[model samples]
Target chain A: MSYHLNHLKELESESIFIMREVAAQFERPVLMFSGGKDSILMVHLARKAFYPANIPFPLLHVDTGHNFPETIEYRDKLVEETGARLIVGSVQEAIDSGAIVEEKGYNASRNYLQTHVLLEELEKGKFDAALGGARRDEEKARAKERFFSHRDEFGQWDPKNQRPELWNLFNGKKNYGEHFRIFPISNWTELDVWMYLAMEGVELPSLYFAHERPVFAREGTLLADCEYIHKRPEEEAAVETRMVRCRTIGDMTCTGVWESEAKTIEDIIKEVSIARKTERGGRTDDKRSETAMEDRKKQGYF
Target chain B: MDNYDNMELLRFTTAGSVDDGKSTLIGRLLYDSKSIFEDQYDAVRESSERRGEEGVNLALLTDGLKAEREQGITIDVAYRYFSTPKRKFIIADTPGHIQYTRNMVTGASTANVALILIDARRGVLEQTRRHAFIASLLQIPHLVVCINKMDLVDYSEETYEKIKQDFEEFSYKLNVNDVHFIPISALKGDNVVTKSENTPWYDGSTLLYYLENVHIGSDHNFIDCRFPVQYVVRPNSDDYHDYRGYAGRIAGGIFKKGDDVMLLPSGFTSKIKKIDTFDGEVDEAYPPMSVTLLLEDDLDLSRGDMIVRENNQPEVEQDLEIMVCWFADRPLQPRGKYAVLHTTKEVRCIVKEIRYKLDINTLHRNEEDKTIGMNDIARVVIRTTKPLYYDAYRKNRITGSVIFVDEGTNETVGAGMII
Candidate 1:
């Protein structure tokens, strides 16, 4: 008596199918967990993908060390709950080791430096596939990404020379050292993510909800006043107590918090539906250049 | 009640030449459906103004890559997602040039509908026929012939009818099940999201209405039982001991507990003890469902194994006759060895012979043109190292399709549909 699946159900099933393919194809696969809503959703889907059994893959967190405290706590709790292995690739360690130099400025972030650390981690772990929460609708460059995006031995993404992914069949075959960056939720938009979150009742970091946090204004975006961010003196940004929430979570210096009264998932969905800009519109890292994402992706940033 | 209780999904691909307004039509669909957010619209507007276009170019919304925007053409396939209250749609927007035939095939392979745009003044062009033929080759369930630029033809019913008739006659060679025609100007927002007052004589559902209402439930094969085991789920933990579930997405037919099933390549028979989903164990499972199956007997099953009904089984042969759409730039070499990927099974294969190359324009077979180049469709015979379990593509799409991979480059060189 069953008919067609609803949109959310269809998306879930599609994601589950992809997750299973990753498990079945690659020998060493890892879920890229950012402790954001998108990555949280990825963990949820991966868990469901191998239900009645623990996820065969480990959760790799490319930790920038500029994370919100709540996100780290939630990430640890999630790992404990799922019993999935956690591997942290630290950007701070990369900076400390002088492998990647830390940028120094008001808009300085560990975002770009994450590629070197991530690639080093991937090589060390010998992971053949890294499942990400990247959605195409988030950025223009991402829209051109394939579900089974191949990365060379150097962990570089060739936007022009990607394999044509036809149908549900994703070609995960690659050379010995070359690997694939799998995006199961590449088709999901920000609003769809919210709708799915509300529908599934998935747990997320508390930073996503509205709270009175000390924030400073920088380039029309609200930046959380944290130790990781070094504000320039000329930049007239004073710490203010405003009801704010994060649309996306990343490095504390790059991820922006927006003024909002919407605290719950339903409220977030409503706000997202009527929101004028994309979720990345609030991100300062993408504002560095039009092809910022493309450039970083070329260097293997997940 | 869940918000997505009754929501469904629709996957469609758009095809047209450079100036046939394919990008504009997709833009209009997204724009009129309220899927276009302000920042995205503003970005496109900014780019349009920077390019010195007088009016805001809607096509800029889809030309995402910098090279595409610079050349003003879609170079590769880009997937777009948007939704209405009734349905969610995934649009596989592909380039229209003959050089990009591989892109069209890649996009159309998974789509339920093929939205082929035809310029009203130009009628059914060669690109239209090529797109329709590819849709047929891919077995896309629905073919939507959007007669775009109707405003250029004054929205004349006679013009629409003439083109529709020409398309129908041309489509006679195609194997698509549902054929629909709509005349409208995607640039003008007519009969796309709303009924056009200009086309009062035409009594049909709008493009959006048709997309939201198209029946896609029966598109998958449910009569033939075929399940390819993708992975074996084993939890060596203490809580649940000795739990072995075969994990895979059901390719065809339906399975219930206690149903008699047989494993391919091994001939091991087992009864379905339980159909497990993420939610819980379900009573029955059908095609395209990713689930775990707990069998009554503990059988040694691994990846590349197929599960089927006791009575019905797919063809197990080492040699296969298939129609291949070559994707690589290098021409196919006779007796060339390749890595064949079919239904989670990877096997070494060699080209046995080239039957004939298909002339996409004339629908004729040229037996002399044995050297198939990139984007060329030809009947090819292949011999695999091991016997592959599959059904004819016409009967079951999931088991029938296969792709040839270049072992050195690991690139998918050709897509094959078994006869």
Candidate 2:
């Protein structure tokens, strides 16, 4: 018998170990669910971490109110099927209560505004730990993120003064009123996530597969033509139905759609293996500036 | 895609300063392997051109943070991932400056291999010695020394041989088991992903080929059966009212059904009734695999308890001699009390004595001055409040290591390996 575990199995075990650590270490931990593939994978691992018992934590979703219709439907179905409690923190509620103001421009998105709502929800819930689905391979700033990332009382991140993490021993000790943003899938790559999902036969939203959607070109990216996005004068003429799929699931206003004919999980696996662009290449939120993700992360964006 | 299930994962660490072409070597690996997406490459190229560089500066690829990009130095460890058809690789890129010894140790803690880059123009520098010392101290299973910048020396075979010999002589004092030497030019992409004909005297495999085919299957400990319980799973539902499972990631050895195991700190013995995973029941489990074990008898157990084979029990002692690496700005005080975390157990420990500090650069023991400051490695004696079940760090990396947490600030200030 070969004692070697394949890359996917190794990754799975690592993630499960991290989840169990969080469950044992923190008092009130919450799994931050975004209805994306990474968050879906996190829920699956959480179930595996403590098999005999239900997921000991609630799933918090900071609803942007600009989500794809299919995403919300899938999120509700998954919450019911897994028997996990769902906590929604609405961005619209935060906006209506004068907690945050909506941005006004042709390219305005609620992506940045979700940070305020999330922090507020976490504070209200008194959650000691928030498990996110951020991967190191997704962006530049995330590459230096620790598995147990610490946040100050104000929910800000100080990248330069992070505690050194050694081996499998993670130091989750923090001061009062301060919390941690735990990333169990920090070591997984985009390809590894896809492979695991395929191997487990996990289901995803319909937006991930190819379909005819009305989209318009904005800065060479195909943005879904929806009521949430305030298109420019020139972009209005470019709206047309095309076969497309979403590489990443964000707010409908910011997530880019790829023009492709591949519709099945197998097709996606083959496409991602040889793809030239990164999954984040189509994310308009990262295109705001070279240091956009870094700045937002420092401000406590998931 | 067909071989995805059979692919293995190998993690390696690289240490170098700004001028050692560490960034260029990493960039070459990712680029040649087609792991760098077009958008990422375009961003790097644009940033390079804006700074008036002649061509795309590969050094900008690994520098992620804003301050690092501005100061032109890596302040912390950044992880990078790439893969060939045969294996997946994770690179823990760290700075080689003497001040960043803490970061280097953190990266080396989990690496299977260490890649030490030696500039060919400067045979073996003090920085190279420091990197080798840390890798050896961390007990990395393999080491690959790449003599970079062969193009600068006109691909001289004699120059490469002298550096290799000097490094070997110095490494003899360390505890490294496997070491390989390679000649390459990271800037010009020679012997990185593919073999270059510039050095006809060299007959070794390329850097990528060596990384892909390195023997790392035996790196884990399979002789001592040890499992540190992390959490206990109990469901009080009607269908399974009395189910109690001990959950943890196996630290070492192989545990099978019907194996007689002893619980640590309690010394109670029981037989393994079953091994459970998310998928289903399994007959046996090995190191690094997280699984739940059900004992034949309901024994009183909780977190911080270790389950090991009866015959291979670890040493349980309150007094420990450890090799300490200080990581905090505040110097380690004599007889200072802090929280020590080993495996799943946390206990308060006091520094009993400061055995001499080891000078990492010279590999000398300084017995006169015993002040342990930041980035200093020393041999110290500590006494914990409770006895800890552990092995020598060289025997089991997972079960033998510990971290000291500052009680006041709640920051991890030190890491120690059991001696």
Candidate 3:
């Protein structure tokens, strides 16, 4: 019967609906694009939400300066293809202006500092709502996040005092200066995202598939040999060739790759289907503490 | 290979006492369906070992928040996603404690099915009736009373039938249209994903089986057309100019390409020229499908304006009678003004009167006490500054439900089902 929708189609409809709501409700809204799979999927859904007509909002990229060069290239290409405006809020700018302090040591990352740049961008753009691809299944703290997550004037998320989002009726009412971090795909798990991408034939960065990349092992996780990471003198991390791929894309200093031979989307789906570890298991940023994500989210990190 | 990508989506909410194995039931569902990853299972296993629990605690899987884990209680509603080969499920795992009863209302608001867990040993407690009442009040289409911990009750048919009879007696008072009873042991893995041989006398589909096969297609009202325009798309480009389309998710009924529609408040009439999606134009669009409608005539319409079939129109009124479940810490004061959010529309409203407060446990109406505190359900009469196009809760759920946001704090203070 035509009554039931396929899982992927259903999720697409849901995401499109949320994107439309954000466009309709907020005075000025922007989609947070990281050139990652989830963000790419969100941008793709936004296109579907308002076809023929351009996406009402621009894509805001909170650049960590530690992102892969390929990611930047990919981001520019997508924006060019869609004819959507791109606004870059650089962490380097924040660091240069002494607005945010840079972390030290080998494990130090620009992940946390990106929040400051993001907040600055929101203020600069006067955007009332920021659409993010943060999924509930990504982390424990994210599990409690609402589709329309209300942020205070300081852009801090109060997990304790979240507005009850029931049904498709999202309460977008907010005071001036206070904004919302709306997650259109909050209900989607990592697997659902991968499957949707595969079904929709949406392209992602080359880093997602397996390829020969020079990487080093640190804290029992594979870190890409990039200029962003600072290795201590005592710790020996030699560049070695390995078939690796990123489960979750982020700043090179914080994100880690996993050993995989999955080169195609179908292969990646199969690998993910039987994958034991959580997608963030390879993330060095989340390993900082028990509630690292929650702490950062409270400080306005998406 | 199973085509899970084509499975239909089902959103369900679970309600029960703190120790009634609500989390355990969800864990069982996720674990059995292979939704739980190996790392997640190991993490939970390690946590259980650290806590010195006897076995790998399934309940540990659902206790997602750090505060919940520290306190050993679910403090709020946590949305959990899992999928079977047949269907996809979104479980709104709400806390069962009395203080967090509003969480149950929040969770049940969008659910197609309300899953109420009953401890077999305890039979039907007041808590069970309370949850059932909330589910009925929320107008959740289906009710599945899962009699959990059957192993503790010796898996006896007599016990199952007794509990079923007691449940039926109480359910008679509920307005739930579809109700099913499944004797399950979330801990023992019986009558959950597979049919349990323990209850040979009670031949019924397993919980997962029933969830997959439940008749939810007809759950939505396909009779009355309701399309609350969320946004208007006008691309000022070289390729195509002078094009205006209304973008929104169809709240109810089927909208065809050549349908005559009327816009609210503006009293403008237009005929649908095309129902478009990103992929292409479609023959018809139904409830929950996000599509763009290009009307034959360009009417002055924006967000908050609704388009409906001229013949079947919803009640457009300013005075609303609603059964509100208060969510804020501050009690709702009579004549106090708050922001009322319905669909995509937001309007300022004042509490005109309090019809009565509903005691969830006893289902008693206390008209004497007028103060609507946190987790209290009361029939509130609200007078909005602007008219809200709506329908009765029984007729159309999407348009019927509304949430009140405090003007000062901006917190969603109350959830209401229009009576």
Docking class of 1: medium
How far in Å is the alpha carbon of A220 misplaced in model 1?
2.6
The digit string of per-residue lDDT tens for model 1 on B222-313 reads 89999888878887888668888888888889888889999989999999999987789888888677888999998889889999987999
Per-residue lDDT of candidate 2, residues A7-106 (tens digit): 9999999999999999999999999999999999999999999997889999999999999999999999999998999999999998999989999999
Model 2 in CAPRI terms: which quality?
A: high
- Ranking the candidates on TM-score from highest down gives 2, 1, 3
Docking class of 3: medium
lDDT of 3 by residue, B1-419 (tens): 26765678889999998789999999999899888888778878988999999998988777876788887888878889887777779999999998888889889988989999999999898778889999999889999999999999889888888989998887887798899999999998898998888888778899999999997887778889999988888888977698898889888888999999999988889899999888999989987788989999977998899999999999999999999999888999899999988887889999999999987666789999988898888998999999999999888889998989898887889988998
> Across residues B135-247, which tens digit of lDDT does each residue of candidate 2 receive?
99899999999999999999999999999999998999999999999999998999999899998999999999999999999989999999999999997678769899999
Q: Which candidate is the best by DockQ?
A: 2
Q: Pick out the ten consecutive residues of candidate 3 chain B with the lowest summed lDDT.
A: B1-10
TM-score of each: 0.97, 0.99, 0.95
Cα error, residue B190 of model 1, in Å, equals 1.6
True contacts kept of each: 0.64, 0.80, 0.76
* Residue pairs in clash, model 3: A6-B6
